[model samples]
Target: MLPEFPMSRQCPYHPPAGYEELRKEGPLAQVRLYDGRTAWAVTGYDETRRLLVDPRLSSDRSRPDFPVLVPRMAAAKLVALVGMDPPEHDVQRRMLIPSFTVKRVNSLRPAIRRIVVERIEALTADGRRAADLVPEFALPVPSTVICELLGVPYGDHEFFEEQTRRMLMATSTAQEAAAASAALIRYFEELIETKLGEPGEGLLDELITERLGRGELTREEVASIAMFLLVAGHETTANMIGLSILTLLEHPGRLARLRSDEGLAAGAVEELLRFLSVADELQRVAAADIEIGGRLIREGDAVYLPNAAANRSPEAFPDPDVLDLERGTRHHLAFGYGVHQCIGQNLARAELEIALYELAVRLPELSLAEPVSQLGTKPGGSVQGILRLPVRW
Candidate 1:
């Protein structure tokens, strides 16, 4: 019998133990999902990179054969870039590329640094002995940056954040997820109209004044893009920030090195990203028949790429399980690969570098307020993140 896909990890920082057996079996192997459907699980580094960039595969969630890693993920209609294929995906991605370029993202470093410092001050503002890093620090840095970048009112963050959480949680009922999705759609629709009339100096305004006005994109498309940006902008990076901090805390030697040497900051971020492939899986559907790993995948077949498995494959990096700050990790799939690769990666990289550096410098004596095993994580979610990171300095 084939091992099941989407296996739960015994430990939060690693992939499920079954992945080792699967990897040893072959690059691609058949596995059953919770829905009782059989799909191909891509586990090897070479196969994963190939399949991610393969044009024969479609990211379209609307496709009948699209792999639904979790039932809740399939409940919503395909509206974001993750669910769109070429031509459509190409057009939408092009419009938003300028704002996320390395130069543009670097320009916000000063502001991101300020946000990090401010959040740290706020975390200790009341002279509290301990604080939850998730909400207080991780969540706020990216949330504030994305809000300021898109001109979204930071005041409305709580509502949208909660709604987004519900939508992504695998345990959420279809009805609940759908309702949250509807609320976000409604919110963005209204916001788009407001930006249309009196444009602000943000990505949303640029989309309105440039893309929509030039007929390059429709109003609904702009709204969908905005919704995508708002959710993707903060959630993934926040989770990563929390996870990175926890990982560093677990390795005091590395943490001490980071504090002592500023040059290691960038490489450390990449290494942490590699060490923890936060997203459990990347789903795709074969748009046409294709042969991979000496096996033929028919058109309309589902494929699931377990990033955690691929990232940890010894074939890609020796001693894959170990986290080395000096490791050559530029090839990590934490941000993904191919045309669907994360567009906001530049922004994320900047946030991680600055956030980690500030924490090292300002809170040199920071330590977990509670035992590591006592911490909670979001179960049954695509993005793996700490639920709460209690810490004290």
Candidate 2:
């Protein structure tokens, strides 16, 4: 019998214990999902990249054969940019590319640094020595940055954050997930309508004026896109920030080295991304017959590409288990591979670089306040992260 898919992770920083065994089985191995349905788990680095770029692999969530890790995800599927296939995916991706380009992200560096500093100051205010970095620092830095960039009022973060948590939580029921998604879509729709009447200088406004006004996209489509960006823009980065802090504090020598050498921050961020692989897996389905890694995938067959396993593959990274801040390789699948790769990756890179560098320098005494084992982690979900990261300075 095939092992159940998404084997639990004993340690938050590492992949599931079964991942190495699965990889040993071969690049692609059959694994049973939560529903007792089988899917191909792609564990090899080269194979995962090849499959990601293969045109025969479909990201469409609406496909009946599409694998849903948890029951809630079935109801939460909204075919936005990530879920879209080419032609449509290419078109929509191109529209948003300009905003996330290296130059554009570079231009926002000052703002990102400001946000990071603001969060750090807030966390350390009143001579505070300890804090749950998740809410005080990690969460707000990206949330505020994304909110500002998307024209969504940051004041309403509590409402949307709750909704996003519900939508992404693996424990959520189908109806609960659907309701949270619907609430977000409705919120974006209202925001779009308001921006239509009174414009602002943000991505949402630009999409409305350029795409919606030009008839290239409908209002609902724009809203859906906004909701997708709003959720993804913050959640992943926030988790990465929190986990990066924990990982760095665990290795004080590396943390000291990073704090002393500002130039190493960029490479450190990349290393952290590859090491953590925070977003666990990328789900897809075979659009047609495809053969790779000595395995045949028939049309409509579901596929799971676990980024954790791929990033840690010894074949791809020498000393893959060791955390080397100087490992400057950017080939890791942390931001994913191929065309559907994260649109805001440049922005994410900038945020992580700034946030980590600032925290290390500003609070040289920062350390974990509690045992790593005592920390709560998010339950089974598409993404994996610490629920609350307690820290002291």
Best by lDDT: 2
C-alpha lDDT of residue 304 in model 1: 86
Which lDDT tens digits does candidate 1 get at residues 1-393?
666667766666777788888877789888888788888988898899999999999998777777777777766543678889898898889888999999999899999999999988887777866788998989988999999999999999999889888888777877887888888889988988887777788888888888889998888888888888999898889889999999899999999999999899999999888888886688888989989887788898888888888899898999999989999569988778999999999999999999998998889889999887688766644578778899989
Backbone-clash count (model 1): 0
Count clashing residue pairs per candidate: 0, 0
- What TM-score does candidate 1 get on C-alpha atoms? 0.97
Q: What is candidate 2's TM-score against the reference? A: 0.98
TM-score (all chains, Cα) for each model: 0.97, 0.98
Highest TM-score scorer: 2
